[model samples]
Target: MPPAPLLLLVFNRPSLTDRLFEAIQEHTERPIYIAADGPRADRPADIEACQGVRDLVLNRVAGRDVRLRFQPSNMGLANHIPSAISWAMEHEDRLIILEDDCVPLPGFIPFADELLERYQGHPSVAQISGSNYQNGISRTPCSYYFSGIPAIWGWATWKRAWKLYDRTMPGWDALRNTPWLSSLFHDPTHAHYWRTLFDDAAHPAKGSLESWAIPWTFNLWTHHQLAVTPDSNLITNTAQSAGTNSSGTSHRNMSPATGIEFPLRHPETVSRNEEADAYAMESFYLGSHPVERFFWRLRLPLRLAPLRRILRLARRHLTHPQPGA
Candidate 1:
């Protein structure tokens, strides 16, 4: 079957969008949907850049089956992304989604297409993610492994799964204080990290980072759903440092995009890879070792505490715990 329809989400990034669109054109002949969020009023340069991206995509897509949704006003990432996906899903049952910076490798489209069909109506599998953040570690011998953490750098999902996304995350209030989140992970720190993020996502302070993916992940978790992550990293995030919300360069951005092998090896059963999830939580999300993370929760006054002292103390205590001290 033809690959599932693809949706490209763009903003004020013409060069990145063009690069990603070229990759898509070379890979699949499926219908393409382009969604661009409008320029921010505060950024005068955004107007011209956004239009340039729109013009570039339109020019490239000549007579192909393409649909466009260019917003008149800025809806921001949290609103625009979910809204765009919802709009596209109204026409297609399933869709492969990519941001302007997420360039896919050769086999990503077909890989997603196969899994989209394979996991159709599978209650546990809510997403097919092309990005793997295992730092070259293969969690399973199978072509892909199931994860509770949904990676959205490049991904595909069905309308049924998208329907569960709620921006406000209404259910978070009831589950926040309970052990429900803790039960999902092998380490309590992982659960604690997510709980803090979900708390901020559900009840946002003014001028905070607006992330749609966090709530979407929470929605999946609340419903006990998992995402299929390929063993090989198939997508490269090209704009990690230059993007509007990015803090600085990351090692993840340096990772190369590699294609998946054909004739996928299917897993015998559907289950989340706890080891992989823990690794992701520690290395990717927290960006620290387990001992360092333990010290992070102590709420030590940074101004008074020296970094070297804290690390030295953390190493000593974490490496050797006292009995009933």
Candidate 2:
């Protein structure tokens, strides 16, 4: 089957964009839609970098069915991303989305294509994600599992799902004072972490939005939607330092990008994998909660012991010089 239409979100990062473009070319020659946020006025360097990226992408996709939405002025990430996606969804029913930093594995496009078709009619299945953060643990016996959380490192979704996305998170106002979060997450810590984040996203103090993913996830949860996560991680996020929100830090034991096997062994029933969801919540999102933070601090020394021991052994080896010398 032909691959799903792809929307490549880009900005001033030409190097990352070039790498991701090459990876996409290596995988499939599907119709490409490139959206670039214009350079920020305050950052003089952005002017040249953004133009360079636009030129590079246009030159590379010279002989293809490629579309462009290069913004004239910077919309910022929180605004640009959703708007760009909305623009793309207007043209296509289903779309595979990748950011300039999200380098996909060989199987990512094919995996997304298959799942997009399989779940096209299923309204409850909101998206297909190429990210798996289970630290090598298979959440299900099948090729993919459902989760309440949507990993957007690399993902695909239908127009139906995209239509549900509201950046303001209007539903949070009604559910904030109630037991809605608790009902969704059994663990109070996990619930609390998300509640605080949702509150912030819903009502930004400075009238500035920090993330599009938070509201996107909020929309999924409010609508009781599930995201399909592959058994293997298929997208590697290479924008640690260059990303808007990333702090150049990684999870303690997150899984790395790997290819998914063909002829997917799908789950018999479409249901959320609670255990997997909980692990992700704790490892990725809940780390900032006061209680979770305390516990993580307590465990930090223990988690570093193995690395410390390795360093000690290396020092001893260097001091003794007993092997080849």
Clashing pairs in 1: none
TM-score of 2: 0.85
RMSD of each: 6.9, 7.7
For candidate 2, give the lDDT of residue 37: 94
Q: Cα lDDT for residue 256, model 1?
A: 60
Instruction: Write candidate 2's Cα lDDT for 198-315 as tens digits.
Output: 7667876553336789899999988889999998889887755353422211223346887888788989999999999898876665432344444433433322224234434554
Tens-digit lDDT track for model 1 on 1-325?
Answer: 5579999999988889888977887754688888999988888888898899889988988888889999997888888999999999999999999999889987898899999999989999999999887888888889999999999999999999999998889888998888898788747767766776676678766434478988999999888899999998999887553545322111233236667899999999999999988878766666445656555456343421243355556666666867875
Determine which window of 10 residues in candidate 1 has minimal summed lDDT. 245-254
Per-model TM values vs. the true structure: 0.87, 0.85
Q: Specify the highest-lDDT model's number.
A: 1
